[model samples]
Target: MNRQIERWRTWVWVLPAVVLLVVFVYYPIVDNIRLSFFSWSAFSTSPAFVGLDNYTTAATDPVFWHSLWNNVLYAVISLIFQVGLALVLAAVLEEVVHQRLRGILRTIYFIPATISITVAGILFSFVYNPQIGLLNRALGAVGLGSLAQDWLGNPQTAIFGVIGMSQWQSIGYTAVLFVVAIQRIPRELYEAAKVDGAGHVRTFLSVTIPLLREMTTLVVILTMSGAFLVFNEIMVMTAGGPSNSSQVLNTWLYHNAFLTDDMGYASAIGTVIFVITFSISAAQILITRRRRVQW
Candidate 1:
């Protein structure tokens, strides 16, 4: 009887979290899946059973494909600039022997990350403005005026311009995560590398990089997911404009749901995003786990 009471108390502690998850997470997901199978507008009183018509429509939509491709581009760029560059920056900071200098530099780098995304987006919009923006002015001052164009207005460069802003905002945040991981490594390993006459480059490549595998995997998953789910930057910067060139999946879904009033279609897009992110994250975890087991 005492054991039964103890078990009940333990469950009582866990019950609130379970209830919250069911209500907020699981319920929304299940509802989205149900909604994706119907035809409904936000104004509709009753949803009609559509039987995968929304999915079919999405498959045939050119703008959907474009948005999906832009998301892929975003992920690729983030993997390179956000994750890879942050790793390099973190390694450089870790090598700095002066603690004060390292701390100052780290703080400087991380400042952009603490700013609100909406604010950052608005700030970059002005920075990329054609006539009076800082970027074009600097380019013109440096005699590179020929290279300056409408960064956010040109269809070819719009997505990349938005991505550049995102990188500036997020790279420091990713670097901080790497810094924590680097600090956890045993100092004896660094000593051993030094005793072997390993130079700074060699030490970083051989010692630091090898020990950071788990952290790298984590950063990659986070950056990739964020890339795909990007909405605010696009919304504030270009509104996925200049002919829908910068439209991403999330923005496209927003357009469908709010502007077009196609909630069912929007739900279908959301479901697809869920599936893509989940599958990629699951595959990453499995692969990372297997590698860890092998090591």
Candidate 2:
């Protein structure tokens, strides 16, 4: 009887969190999925049941496919720069740099990540501006004037410009995470590598990389999922402009929801985003679990 009462007391403590999740998170997701199956807009009083029409529309939409492709491109670039290169940078900072200098460099690298995404986006916009922008001016100063062009104005370069800004802002944050992971590694392992006559490059490949498997998995998952869900920077930078060339999934969803007032279609896009991110996360976790490091 006493144990039952104690269990009930524990349930009482857990109830608030459970209720909050159901009300705020789970309920909204369910409602959004429900909305995806109905034809509704901001002005609609009566939402008509549309079955799979919205999903079908998204499937057939060329812009939707393009947006998805942009997200894939974003994911690939983020994985390379944010996760892969960040790991190498983190290794260099943690293993090679003096302790005091490492701190300063880490702070310098992470400053961009501390800035607001909107601010960074706007700042990069100026940097990419054609006529008087820093990038073009630098190119001209270096006698590479022919290479200077409108970055965000041209569809060919707009997405890449946004991606470059994202990488610059994010790479340091990921590197810091790797730095922490690298710090957690036992120093004895490095000493062992040294005793075995392993050079820096060999030590990194044999010792650092293997131990970092878990952190690498986590960073990759985060970078990929975040790429698919990107919105603010793209919105502030290009607004998917110069002919819808830079439209990512979230921005496109926002465009349909608020701008076009097509709430149902927006919900459908939201569903797609959820499905994609969930799948990516799940697949990563599953694959990583199989190869997780053993003590």
Query: Model 2: per-residue lDDT, tens digit, 96-179?
Result: 999889999999999999999999998999999897799999999999999999999999999999999999999999999999
Quote the positional error of residue 136 for candidate 1 in Å: 0.6
Q: Give the least accurate 10-residue stretch of model 2, judged by summed lDDT.
A: 286-295
Best candidate according to TM-score = 1
* Candidate 1 per-residue C-alpha lDDT over 163-241 given as tens digits, one digit per residue, 9 for 90 to 100: 9999999999999999999999999999999999998889999999989999998998999989889999999999999
Model 1 TM-score is 0.97
Tell me model 1's lDDT, rounded to 2 decimals: 0.94
Give each model a TM-score. 0.97, 0.96
Candidate 1 deviant stretches above 4 angstroms:
none
